[model samples]
Target: MNTTTAATEANVTVATIRDWARRGIIAATKAAGRWVIDTASLAHRIAIGAMKRPAKPARKATFSVETMLAIGGSRWQKNGMDRVYINNWANFLPLEIDQYKTGNISWAAWEGQEIANRQALLLLGSIDKVWFDSADGELHGRFGSGESRIATRQEVWETVVAGIRTAIAAL
Candidate 1:
């Protein structure tokens, strides 16, 4: 039968029938320059319930500000940083973190700001002068010229809190 007639009989769109034909899900042949679908094959396949569209994949989850804050806040407390300092940092950091979480800012931009925050805390004597060297991918401390080690974001938060603890202890 003609593509349109076959599609109407199958209760599907002509486009869907054409796609099935192209994908070899259903068989078709050209007769006198017109596409002809065999009714026998189509009916047999329909009876057996073989025709179906492929399922789409689910979306992956992105990072959230709440999760980041929880992890960072826990680390801050564990590192013995002063409550006042931790509270102040927590209050200001959320705006930027939210921007990152919502994808308004890139990962590189967020990392840059984080690095700047680390530097500022060091200058204010709230934390030791620890810096991340992007060139060599190493973290350096103020006490020594050489790199101490590489650190993850959580580890960086720990270091920042430790610095705050030291500054408070000195007071």
Candidate 2:
């Protein structure tokens, strides 16, 4: 049968039949400047549904709180913060920041309430020797002590959020 007849009988487009012929999926021959599909081969393929397209591969999830945190941690370290300090801060902050970014909570409330809590202060103090300077209210790395300047509470929170954003963009 000709390509048009095979396509009409199989309930598919002429282009689809032509593609199958080109791919050698269904046996066919050229005659009179046109493809002549073997009626038996076309019938078999239609009956068995072998013409259906293959399944696509599953895609990876691109955005998640954990992935954002990991990216933030790498960015933080790249910015010269100590590894120990970065790890400690990352553990303390994963959930709160995730919540903020996901719009579960307002940024003002998170910065003013959650970040201003005594527990937050203690977490900062814990990493003082490595990154934070409680006396000067600055976050400093081992390498850039001279360039370190005092950072306010809001600036610190902004820094964390910025790192998270930078990480997400990298992904």
Candidate 3:
């Protein structure tokens, strides 16, 4: 099987597969913008002690936000709530969504956006509607009446932690 496909099937990231290659735990070669791995070697590594298994991060309502950011951005984020919210949302999107070259695409290239938005709704939560009432104060009143089927904030944090553990184990 193809190395990249095998790694993904095994729930291991490409970087981790590469590290295993460099460490002589897996045989791989870059070909056609993809890495091919020897299935036999991978199994051997898993059987022996050369390849360490990944451990899931401890669950917590409030894990280090910086650690979550580091899992992808390589830098800890200490910005305010808005920035953090955006980052969290971005992390949940597909890599293609994050990689969109908005500058080159025309306005008509948004069917993809609709698909992504719908998928995000399922993965995160649906935004039924938001209301802003300016009757009380300058801030007014806000409400989030979305479907409650998606992941909670704590669940999202735990998912991030799990992802980080998977990534670090590969590295």
Candidate 4:
């Protein structure tokens, strides 16, 4: 059988089948510049693979704020970035109610924010109506309508932790 057919039968990739043939781990021959795998040899290889012990699970890589940030100030953040740069990243992690009066999107106080569905959700706790109170400098929200309770800074940080930063680090 061809490498493709062998790979399907063996429950592996075609590349793996080719590699095995190249390494002489399976009885195969090249005809018309393609690998022809022997059925008996493929069966033998499958049996051997089944007999082998499963490999240990990979160690979970550290991907939290502490592990990925430039600062460890009880937050995931950095300072000294220019206004344009900060605003750009702040837009990356947008808020449902953005009322930055100064147009200065805070970026240094966003710790543990990626877990929230939206920045407002972080403070509002999964609500329908949400808004930012610029005068009080807080987020506001309620169950379905009418009057909003302020989402205080004490409830969550003012700044936003850009998810792109952590996402890149993961790669």
Local accuracy of candidate 2 as per-residue lDDT tens digits, 1-171: 766577668755455676798898899986533567998989888877745755335444344434534543332334543232344333222212213355442321122223423343333433232243333434443321221123444444555544434344534
Q: Clashing pairs in model 3?
A: none
Instruction: List ranges where model 4 is wrong by over 4 Å.
Output: 54-171
TM-score, one value per model: 0.28, 0.29, 0.37, 0.33
Model 1 lDDT at residue 134: 32
Clashes of each: 0, 0, 0, 1
Cα lDDT tens digits, model 1, 1-171, are 766666657755444555666677778875443456888877876666544644334433222323223323221233532221133332221112212355442211121223343433332233234433333433334332222123434445564544333322322
On lDDT, the stronger of 2 and 3 is 2
Name the lDDT value of residue 53 in candidate 1. Answer: 46
Best by TM-score: 3
Candidate ranking under TM-score, highest first, comes to 3, 4, 2, 1
lDDT of 4 by residue, 1-171 (tens): 866577668755454676799899999986534567999999999999878956435444333333423222122123632111121222222232222477433321122122222444344332333333333433333443222133443232222232333333433
Please give the distance, in angstroms, between residue 12's alpha carbon in candidate 1 and its true position after superposition: 0.2
Q: What is the alpha-carbon RMSD of candidate 4 to the true structure?
A: 19.1
Question: Which candidate number has the best lDDT?
Answer: 2
- Candidate 3 per-residue lDDT, tens place, 60-167, comes to 332233433444433222442212121333232221122236532111101122233344444444322111112221111122233323444444444444544554
